[model samples]
Target: MAKRDLRALMQPAAAGMFMKQFLRWALVCCAGVFLAYTLSALKVNKAPSDPWAAHCLSQFLSDARSFSTATSDLKTTVNDLSAGDTASLTHARQALLRCRLSYKKIEYFMEYFFAYPVNLYNRAPVHEIEEPYMEYQSPVGLQLIEDLLYGEDPFAQKQALQEQAAVVQSTAADIPASVYGFEATGVQVAESLSQELIRVMALGIAGYDAPVCKSGLPESAVALQSVKAVLAAKTAGEQNLYADSCMHYLDKAIVLLQASTGFDTFDRLSLLTDALLPAQEYLNRYCCQQYPGIGGEGAYNYNARHLFRPDALRQAAFDRLAQSDTAAGLVALGKLLFSDNRLSGDNTRSCATCHKPSLYFSDGLKGSPTIGNGGSTRRNAPSLLYSSYQYGQFLDARDASLEKQIYTVLQNPDEMHSRLDDVVRKLDNKTYRPLLRKAFSQAGKQITPAMIARAIAAYERSLSPFNSAFDRYINGDHNAMNVSQRRGFNLFMGKALCGTCHFAPLFNGTLPPLFNRTELEVLGTPDGGSLDKPVPDTDSGRFGIFPIEFYQYAFKTPTVRNAGETAPYMHNGSFTTLEDLIEFYNRGGGAGIGLEVPTQTLSPRKLNLSQAEIADLKSFMLALKDSL
Candidate 1:
C-alpha cells in the first residue's frame, strides 16, 4: 500500500515538469524563426553598386573625340568646295554624310546632355519658316545645308552653307567639353539607352531627322554600332550573359541594315519589334537585377513586353493622387457636378451641354456653340472619352494636368463664364455638400474650387473604360478584327506611319512605359479646308504660351482612339467626315495639299493609298470604338 502511494505522487510531479519543458522549447523555436526573418529582410533590402555607369562615362568621352574630329573635317570640306562645281558639291555631300554618321553614333549623348545646342546644329528645317514669338530666325542646321546643297542652285548658298558649317563645328566642339562636367549614373544610362532606341525607331527610321538625304538606314546602322558600344561598356565588370543577350540582337539589327537594298525595301517594323525592343528589354532586366530601386520613384522599368499600356496612366500619377479618395464616391460626386448647370454663372449650361455622353462625350459640332451665345469656340470640342490617358490637356498643351485644365474651361468668357467663388457658393447646397463630404471624407470636407476640380477630373478619368474591340484583339481575341481591319493595322504601323506620333494602344503622343511626357506636332492645318488655296490656320498654338520659336504653331497630338466617332477632326474641327480627315493626312496635311507650310511638321508627301486601302484603314479606326 505504501509503494502504490509513492508511485502516484512521483507521476504528478513528473507531468508538471514535462509541461514546463514543452513551453520552453516552443519559445526558443519562435525566437529563432523571428531572427531568421529579420536577417533575410536586411539582405533583400541591400542594393549593390553599379559598374555600368563608370564604364559608359569613359566610352562617351571617346565618342566625343570622334564626333569633334568629324565636325572639323566637315568644316574643311565645306570651305574647299567650289561654287557651281559638280564634283565639289558631291564631295561636300559625302563629307556632310560622314559628319552625320559620327553624330548619329553619339546621338544619345547629344540628345541627353546638350539637347538645346544639338538642336541648333542638327534640327531639321522641315517647316521652319517664321516664328513671331522669337527674333526673326532662319533655319540654321544640317538640314538647312542639305536643302542648299541638294537644290538647283547650290553655289548661290555657298557662303551661307559655310557659316552654318562653322556653327555646327562650334556646337560639336562644345559637346566634348560639356561631357567632362557631367557625371553618369547607372539609372541614367539605362534610361538614355531606352530613349535612344525609341528615337531610332520613331524619328530616325521614319526619315524625320534626315529627310532630304534619306540617310535613315545608314545612320541607323551607325546608331546600332553606338548601341553595341554602350552594351560593351555595360558588360565590363559584370556577368556577360545578360549583356551578351542584348548584344546578339543588336548585332542582328546591324546585319539586317547592312543587308538592306534600300530604304523603301527595309522593314522598319520588323527591326523595331525583333531586334531593338528586345535589346532594350534585356538591358532593362539586367539593370534591375544589378541595382534595385536605382531609377527612382515612378521611373520606367523598361522591361514591359508591350510598348504601351492603358494602366500606365494610373501608374504615372503621383502616389498621393492615386490613393487620395475612393473611386466610387469621387465618380458619383463628379457625375452629379458635371450635369449641374448651377456650376455656371447663369445656370444656363453645364459640362453636359458640350460633352454629351450620347455623342461619345463630344458636342458633334464643327466647333462647340459658345457658352452664352458668344458665337462658337475657336477650336473643336475634343471628346472627353480616353482624354484622361493623355499627358497634357488642351490643343495648345497649356495645362499639363487635367485637374488644372478645369479652371480654364470654367472661367473662360466664351465657355462657363463663371468664377470659382461663384461656383463654390452654388455648390455649397444640401445636394452637393453631403456628396462632397462623402466623396472626400478627409481634406475636402469644405467645397472649394480644388475639390470641385478634383471631383470633375475623377469623372473625366472614369470615361476611359478601355473596352474597345481592338483591346480585345490585342488581349488574345483574334476574331475581334476582320481581315480588312488587320491589314489596316499593318498599314498604320508600317506604310501610313500613324504609330510614329499617335503611339500604339492609347493612340496618343504620351510616350510609353511611363506615359508622362506629351509630344506636339506642327501639322500646318489649313484655315477652312480650302486645299485649292489653302491658308494657314491663324492660331499660333503652343507658341502663344511658351513664346519660343521651336514651339511655333505646335499643337499637342490628340488621341485617335475614337476618331471614327468624333467628327469634325483636327484642332479647328475643319473636316466634316472621316474620308475628309483621312484624305488630309493622306495628302500629308496642308503642305502636301499644295500649301507652302514651311514649318509643317507632317510629312509633306502623298501616301498614295488606294480607295480599297483607305477603306481598310477606316475599318481599323472603327474597331477602336469602346464597348460603352
Candidate 2:
C-alpha cells in the first residue's frame, strides 16, 4: 500500500467520471436542438388563425359556463324539494325552466359537436333501444325531469327527479372539456343554424321536448335568440347582405314565437314559411358564399333552398345503391317483377296484389289475404308511396332496409311464401334474364336475390313523385292547397303534434336534418277502433323484434301522405274511416280511452282538437295525395 499506488487508482476513477459528465452534456444539447426543431415544425404545420371560429369558441365557452351554473342551481333546487312544501316544488320547476332556457342557447353547438353528452342532457324521455346489440338504455336528462315534475304527484317521485337533475348538472360541467379545441367553421355554423331552425319547427313548436310544461314557444324564442347572437358574432364587421337578411328573418321568427298565445294556438305555419324558412335560406346562402364547395356531413342537402323543397334531403343518402347508374332500367324491371306472381310460392300473390296502384300502392282491404290460405297478413299493407324515403321498413321496423323488407315478405309464410333463392331461380325466364342483365350489367352473368331486392328497391325509390298538392304548394304553387288544407297543415305541424313524429315534408318517421334513424312509437292502438270499449292491440309490434319492455306495442310511424287514397289506418287497419282515426288520436290513442299501456310512447294527454280543426287536418291530408 504505497502512496503512489493509491494516487494512481484515484486518477483512473476521476477520468471515468469526467468522461460520463461530458457525454451527458452532449446528449442534453442534442435534445434541446431536437425539441427546438419539433416546435418549429409544429408552428409551421398549424392551421391558419380563424377569427370567426375563435369568437364562436369564446362564446361557446361562456354559454357553457352559464349552462353549468344554471344546472347546478337546478340541482340545488331539486334537492330542496324533498323536505320542502308546494312552494319549494314550484321553485324547483322554475329552476328547471331556467336550466332549459340556458341549455337551449347552446343546444345547436352541443348537439352538432357533442351528441353523446347531449343525450345525457336531453334525450327523449323514453327507454332507448340501442340497435344490433339491442341494449336498453334507461331514459335520463331534462325531458325525464320535466315529466316527473309535471306529473300528478311530483313529491312521490322526488328521488327520481333529484337523480335526473344531478345527471344534467354533471353532464353540464363536462361541456367545456367536451368542446375543447373544437374548430367551428362557417359551414358548420350555417348547417347547425339550419338544423336548429328545422328542430324548432318540427320538434319545438310541436312540443316534442316540452311534453308537460308546454313551454316550447318561449324555449324556441330563446333558441332563436341564441342563433341570432351566433350569426352576429360571425358577421361582426362583415358587410354581408345574406347575413343581414338572415338576422332579419331570425328576429321575425323570435318575435312570432314570443307573440304566441299558447302552444295549440301558435301560428306555426306562418312562422315556418315566413320566418324560419327564410332565415334558413339566407343562412345557408351566407355559408355557401363564405365557404364554396364545402358541405357538412349528414342526410341533409345543404345546397337545397328550404326544408320543404323536393330536393331538400339527399334521398340517395338512405339508399344503399345510391351510386348505381342503372336506376331507370332497374325500376322498369322491378315494376314487372313487382306484379309478377311467379315470385310467390303459390303463383297467386305478388307485391302488386297487396300494394295496388289504384289505391296508391295499398290494398283497399283491412288486411291483405294470405297466399294459399283463408287467413290474412299479420299487419295492414302500408302504401309504397314514399316508403323508400324512410330508414326502417314494415310497421314493426324489423327490417332496416327496403331490400331486407322485400326479402322478408317474399319468404314469410303468410305473405309470398317464396325464398329469395327460389324467386331468383323463378326469374330466370327470357323476359327477366335480359332485364336483370341490363340492370345489373356491372355484376357477373349469374343473378342473385340481392339483385332482385335492389331492382325492387330501385322501383320503390322512384315511387316518390313529390307531385302532391301539398308538394306543389310548398314548391311555390300557392293555389295547390286550399284554405282549409293550409289551416290543417298548420295544425298538423303544430298543435296536433303530427309533425313531431311524422316529420315533414316526408311526413314519415325518418328524422331530420339528419334522417339517419327511424323512430318507432307506441300509440297503444286498439284491436278495434271502438271508442266505447277500447282494447289494446295484442300485437307485440317492435317488442317482437327487440324484446324490450319499452318496445312493447311500439310500431313504426308510417307516412300520413296519401292517406285519402290509402284508407285503413293503423298497423291492424282497425280504423276504417279517417274521422275515426282522427277521433282516436284526439282521444289520445289507447291510453286516453282507458287502455293500460305502460310503455306507450305517445303522450296520454288529449289533443282536444275541434271539429273544424279536424276537418282542416283531413283536408291537408287529402292535399297530400299525389297527382299520379
Candidate 3:
C-alpha cells in the first residue's frame, strides 16, 4: 500500500517536471532572440559614425605586424645577399633599396595614421608637425600590448612570443650586415646585446601605470584607469602625464617576458635596441599633441590609449638607476639663468636677448648690440639654434669647453662685463640653490659654476638641430622641400660650395657630433668694430686657445643647424641682410668689405649667384628653420 501511494505521488511530480523543462527552453530561446535584436540595433546605430572605424583599426594593427615582419624578412634576405662576394653587388643593393622604400612607406602609414588631410592653406601651426618615424615593435612589446588591449592571457601570449624569438634568433644567425643599418651586426653582437638590455629596461620600467588587462571579467577596468588618468592630468605631474598609458604597457611587457623565459643578455639588449625610436616617437607624438584647452604638453582635455605591461621590481630598479636623471628642475633653473639680464653689469641684456628663442635662438642680427649704430652688436648674431652642437666654443673658437666659454663671455668686457665671481655672488644669495641641492643631493655642497654651465649646456645640447626640411630631404622626404628649397639645398652642397665647410648630418662645422670638438675656417671678417682704425687680429681665431699659426683664423664652424636664424652674418657682424651675406659670399668673403684673405676658400669663389641665386641661397637658409 505504501509503494502504491509513493508511485501515485511520483507520477504527478514527473508530469510537472516535464512542463518546467519546456518553459526553461522557451525562456532561453527568447533571451537569444533579444540578444540578437539588441546587437543588430547597436550595429545600425553606431556603425555609421564609425564606418569601418573598427575594421580600419583592426586591419591596421594586423597590417602593422605583417609589414614589420615582412620588412624584417626582406632586410635579412638582402643582408644575406650582401654577404656573398657577388660578381656585382648592384642587384642586391638595388633590391635592398627597393625593399627599404616599401618599408618606409609602411613606416609612413604607421607614423601618420591619423594625419589630417593636407590642406593647401593648412600651414603647420606654431610647431605642430606629423613627421615620419620607423614602425616596428619588439615581439614582447607587440604581444604584451595585444594581451592588454584585446583581453588575451599575458603568460600564454608571452609563451608564443618566446617561440617567435627563438625563430628570430635562428634567422639572425643566417643574416649578414652593413655598418650603416640593422640593429645587430655580426661583429659587435655582444655590445649590441648590452645596449638592447638597457633599452628594453627603459621601456619595461616605464610601463607601470598603464591600464590593466586580463582574460577575466573586469572589462571596464582599463577604460576606468584611462578615464581617471585623463582627468587627473589637470593637476598631476608631467611624469604622470607621460607615463600613464605608454609606461604601463612597457611594464606589463617586461613582466610577461620575464615570466615566459627569463631574460639573458641578448633578450634584454635586443628589446631596447629595437624600441628606442618607437618609444620616443610614440610618447613624443602622444604627449605633445595639442589638447585645445590645456596649455602644457600633456593637456587634460584629450585622451589617448595604450596597452598595459607589468614591469618586475628588479627591472624597474635597474632602469631607474641606469638612466640619466637630469631633472626638470634643473632644466627650469638653467632656463632662468640663461635668460637673466641681472647677470650683466650694465643690466641691459640677457643670453636670450642675444639668442631669441623664436628665431631659432639667434637674434638674426648681423651682429648684436651695435655700439656705434646706437643699435646692439654689429655682426649677425649667429643663431645658437644648434649652437649646442657646435664643436669648440664661440665665434672665434677661443674656448675649448662649455665650462670655459661661459666664463669667457661672462668676463668679456664688451659682451657681459661680469666675472664668474660676481655671477656666483649674485646667484649665491638667491633662493634657487636649495631646489638644486634637493635635486643633486649627492653634490649638495659641491654644486658650483661648472655644474651650472653644464646644466645650461645640457639644455642647449638637448636642442637637437634635427627636423629641418633639408634633413627631411636627406632622410628620404620626397616632398619635404619645395622646388626652391630643394634647388637651393643642391646649390649649397654643390655650386654654393657650402659643404666644403658645413657638412651633412649635423650640417655644422664638422661631420662629428658636438661632443667631439672640431675647428673650421672662414676667409676673414671686416675689421669694423670699436677700433676706428684697424688693428690686425691676424685671424688669430682658435689660436687664442692653441697658440699655433696654422690654427690662426681657423674658427670653429658655426653649425648651420640654425644659421637660418642667427645673422648680421659672420664673426664681426658685417653683412646686414641675408641677401648681402649671400652676395658677399658670391663675391667671396671680406673682399667686398675691404678686408681680403687670399687663402679664404669662400673668397671670390665664383658662386655665379645671380639675383635669383642669391634669393635661392637665402631661401635655403630660411628653410633650415625646420629645426624650429
Per-prediction tally of clashes: 2, 0, 44
How well does candidate 3 score on lDDT at residue 56? 30
Any runs in candidate 1 off by more than 4 Å, and if so which? 1-51, 80-87, 126-138, 151-153, 236-244, 297-303, 311-328, 346-348, 372-374, 385-392, 429-431, 462-522, 533-554, 585-588, 591-628
- Candidate with best lDDT: 2
- Model 1: per-residue Cα lDDT over 218-292, one tens digit each: 888888788778867767666667678878888988888778776544665457557866776676666667666
Q: For model 2, which pairs clash?
A: none
**Local accuracy of candidate 3 as per-residue lDDT tens digits, 480-567:** 7677766566456445556445644445653311113343564555554312233333445655655533344555567665565565
Provide the TM-score for each candidate, comma-separated. 0.77, 0.88, 0.45
Candidates by TM-score, descending order: 2, 1, 3
Question: Where in model 3 is the C-alpha error above 4 Å?
Answer: 1-325, 346-348, 364-367, 370-380, 442-447, 473-477, 512-517, 527-540, 543-547, 590-598, 601-604
Worst 10 residues of 2 by lDDT: 1-10
Candidate 3, residue 595: how far the Cα is off, in Å: 5.8
Candidate 3 colliding pairs, count: 44
> Candidate 3, TM-score vs. the true structure?
0.45
How do the residues 521-547 of candidate 2 rate in per-residue lDDT, one tens digit apiece? 888789877877987688999889777
Candidate 1 contains a number of clashing pairs equal to 2
Off by over 4 Å in 2: 1-49, 80-86, 181-186, 325-328, 442-444
